[model samples]
Target: MDEGCDGTGLCIDTGDGEFMEISLHSRNSFERKKNPSQDSGFEDRGSKSKKKGLSVSDFLTRNLFSRKAKESEDDAEQGWKLFGRIPPKQAPDKDPQQITQEFQNKLRSVAQPKNSKKSDIEVMSTTALILENRPQNLPTKDPEEAEKHRQQYEAMVEAARKKELKELKMKKKQKQQQLKNEDKVVCAAKRWTDEILPNWETMKSQKKTRELWWHGIPTNVQGRVWQLAFGNDLNVTNELYEICCSRADDRIRMTIESSEIYGNSETSSEPPSSKESSVELIKLDVSRTFPQLCIFQKGGPYYDLLHSLLGAYACYRPDVGYVQGMSFIAAVLLLNMDVADAFVCFANLLNRPCQVAFFRVDEELMKVYFHTFEEFFDENMPGLYSHFKKHKVTPDLYITEWIFALFSKSLPLDIACRVWDVFCRDGEEFLFRTALGILKMYEDLLLHMDFCNLVQLLTKIPEDISGDTLFKHIDTIRMNIDKKRFNQVLAVNKES
Candidate 1:
């Protein structure tokens, strides 16, 4: 027998010198010969009357052998597709089983050597045969469905981007709104300068003017408003400030020279007067005041201004003299106004009756203030009031520093300014009210704290307290201080 195969299918030869082809290319490869016995030289085994398709065993027997016995081994092997070009890739749409079976049959047709015995060939698994014969480019998913998923993912990303952009836009809009409110405040100040101040006797009595001051003096006009509030009743002027500053400079220079010569103690055997003590105190406290701000340190921008202001005030008012907390008041004023105006305001501020009594450490006036505050505290927040009494926590511990500095030390700078606004407008009564408001605001927290914690909390008040929230509680409090008694106490102290 002879055997060969082209890429299409197998071919075989029997001793009759004729060839038969079993084409596997497609259905067209199955065209029958006119006379099967003559054309392919195969004996016609089936009866002509039957005319049925060949069974697998009969088909194999007839197709495996042909009469082309003279064909060379190379020629026969040349048509064998098992050793030919790579198999065509299976079409993505073709039935997988049909393709697998086709390749399986094609792989089973290789010829054996003439000397070797023919053993049955065991065909490989359908998956292995298909993988070996077919190219590795089969599609794992439908093309249209993959495109749909890609578009969906892009849409989700775009939506997230839009959401992020929207949030940014809202934040920017809120910031713009804040700026607009600030502009309104600036515009209101302009009206105060151009319209209101010229007719102050009339404008001062108006409800609108009172309301404006209640909100705040705008930052640009704070110096003017402060000067207006405290008034230059003593006719203090730029020239007087210069003269006082000149006098102060001389005293400070002499003191420094004396300290160098006599090692800090005064050369005179007599005790140092308030004037001598004040100059040294002013120099010592200048660096310590507002140390965190850096503007009051030795080499700071406002250092000379603060030093000069305190020195001038101490020299300008030898009667009131300089106290421990005086620099805090002077420093706060210097921040808002020019040196001359700040000195004028500082003199008038300290001249206020309550300020005089407090700075002088008038025992009688302080007792009155402490007594009044205790009454207000008991009235406003009885629970916290009882707690403080139990712990021996008294107003003298905290309110003294608060009122002395006008809360410039106890509260945040901005909130202290708000307190100052009301203090300037409503007078010392608001100070007592503010103390009550603070106690009421932290009543719950204070009620639970022990003695040390209570003292610490009230003295070193936390910086995080909200000004708005505190004032909201403050507005609700209706404190009725005994103004007549406070005045009598302050007046009696001043006379002595």
Candidate 2:
């Protein structure tokens, strides 16, 4: 709901304790920012989220972008480090040269679905009935008391009906507006599709693909862009992917044959081959992947595809085998690319020179990732870093999945995909940049939290958050990380 905390905690009551909160107000704060100096102080405002429990907005009330009273220069620098540079000043809208501009042209042709205006009809007279606790001694046998109870029940029912009707109308109105947004999205997607695919050779890297990606990739065209960002063609990548899949298929048959002939019965001399064991393990994590999304429902085609991709990768790179978080990354890739293409991308990611170490659980290279995260956070956001340190909230508690899954598991889908768009183009620093981005977005709130609340709060992806908002910081704050230092940190730690 809220964006960022302004480094000050506000006292709030929730969960049976008095806690201090220092987070941005929810979605409404975006509007508050439109008129930053509206003269309404803290008491007139509270969080705008309908989500139950104490929200992040109880304390973060300042408009990081308010014009009348802008944040101090230091705060502005910190905001940039956390979220990206402030948005450019709004240029006054000029009269369109033609009535049919791109966004307007896309929507101008679509008629609003019929009866959409009926949502505004008011059911204005439902009286809310308040029925407080009464003594048990009151006799229901009394006619007056019985009649009073009956009226109260009827009024309550009417009130509930009124509430549901109002909400339903609101949902319908929102859906209509969403359809309009969809048209604009389609128009924009068409432009991006033209840039990458049909004209790949011209726009591959000779253009500002990174800047374009940072803006946001149209979901439909994002996968093709990802391939181009990696400087590979679809044909070559698919070929390598298919080869890996064939090898894994062979391995699977061998594993099955060995199992059938050996008839383990706890008496076999050799244990199952690594590939066989990995298949069993992969099966376990397969179902756990994106259980919430319809596309990844258990026993579905997409789920099976995930099975195929992970199996291919494990067989393709025996040394790495399978890791706990690989399933998440593979699932997201499969959503955007063909199964074979997904496998190739997955393998390349694991085999990346610096990134490959992240798969080594609790090993030297893995430790390097954790160290690099700390160094980046310390360099960019020392105040938030010190607060995390003060509370003893270690990186192991949260950064593991972040490094390996690249926030696909914890952040909003669009946000996670945007991160991947950048990751494919920019390399490992993108991960660190996103890591810092998450912390920067939540630093003020985190400063006021204890360990349990801090970890829980940091791990959730609010359904309503916009990835474009999070990606803004990634573009503004350049995380110039050193790959060589990763090796240095590992070497020094090992010697110590």
Candidate 3:
């Protein structure tokens, strides 16, 4: 037999022409079969063989190649790199016997002394367990980078806190300034109303008062000013108002009970006379008037008051009677004054000649007003007038409602009241100027619209109109028609 070594095992060739390889695992059995008495003889033989053929070196070389091949295979299966770098060599796996012995030794090292406390042993074991199971692949952190990130986060938080504080301080400052300005306006208005307004007939400062009136009457004393503006020349008394209210109430009750209600003369019991019809019309208007203000809605606080006031006016004036837009006028008066005072003011306001012509819807007088307004329109804004003529839009279509309502329905309540302030102070002349000013203010838009669009826009006039801007536009208009001039034109038209 001949024996030789390959990287994996030992090869033997038998004389029968067959070869067999010996596994590395047979080393244990081969060692067990060795006799101690024959060891020295084999040792002598091995020394002689090593000198002749280097047998010991050959055996070492074979073992080194086998170990390297096995290691490469293991490394390929488990991956060679860790955390973007080559990993260190792993320790060889231990056998069961070695693992049990190492565990016993570790327990002995961690155990407390025999006389020590049991709690100390438990704490030590817990610490060891945590260290044993903790992950080993995590990379170490840089102290400078970690500290820089922490400081940046703190700086951002501090900056946000300061910004919030600055915004709060700004809001508080603005609110304080607004309150101060309001206080100044209130104090000035009070001073003016108390000192200047009371002695106005003999005062030469009337022009200044008129200028201030054009700006706006302060809300605190607007009612008193309106009362003084429209003086009660109709001689309307509290007794007269109470009498009218009583007649209205009797008519309303009789009508509700479906009984015969008397007309102007108590002798005739006709089918719902003018006064009764006026009450029904007033009922329809009371709920519809100023629907945005809850006080005017049916069953609201001022609902019954508005109804009674309008009903009394209808009973008091059957010739002019309670017109469709009259509720808005009376409602404005009611809001600023008491019921009796409101009735007096309402009666006197309707008594104005310009107001009477419009309330009656008199065609001849309306024609004269329209003629004068058209003359002003052409004189002030010829371009818009030409556009209106192109679209067949006449003054009667939009100007009628504007004059009749006193702009109450067309403009926002606050802006309309401002217009009324100027209108009351200036007279019928301001009405024509205001109409022209409206056309002038919206001239750009009106220049581009068709007939239907122009009529709708002019009749309703948009609520978003700026009050300051509108007044500025109105002030720019220069008209020559005063109340006297308008009356003379109307007389000439009537005579013709």
Q: Estimate each model's TM-score.
A: 0.62, 0.59, 0.61
Clashes of each: 7, 4, 0
Evaluated at residue 440, the lDDT of candidate 1 is 80
What is the Cα root-mean-square deviation between model 1 and the actual structure?
25.0
Off by over 4 Å in 2: 1-183, 201-209, 232-243, 260-273, 294-298, 460-464, 472-496
TM-score of 1: 0.62
Name the regions of candidate 3 deviating beyond 4 angstroms: 1-184, 259-273, 481-496
TM-score winner between candidates 1 and 3: 1
Task: Write out the backbone clash pairs for model 1.
Answer: 5-79, 12-66, 13-66, 14-66, 14-67, 17-67, 18-67
Q: Candidate 2 clashing pairs?
A: 1-26, 23-60, 83-473, 84-473
Model 2 scores worst on lDDT over the 10 consecutive residues at 29-38
Query: Candidate 2 residues 190-228, lDDT tens each?
Result: 877766578776765655754565666788887777656
**Could you give the candidate ranking by TM-score, starting with the highest?**
1, 3, 2
Query: TM-score: which is higher, 1 or 2?
Result: 1
Residue 205 lDDT in candidate 3: 39
Candidate 3, residues 336-428, lDDT tens digits: the string is 899999999999988887789898878887787787778778777988889999989999999888777788878898888888888778777
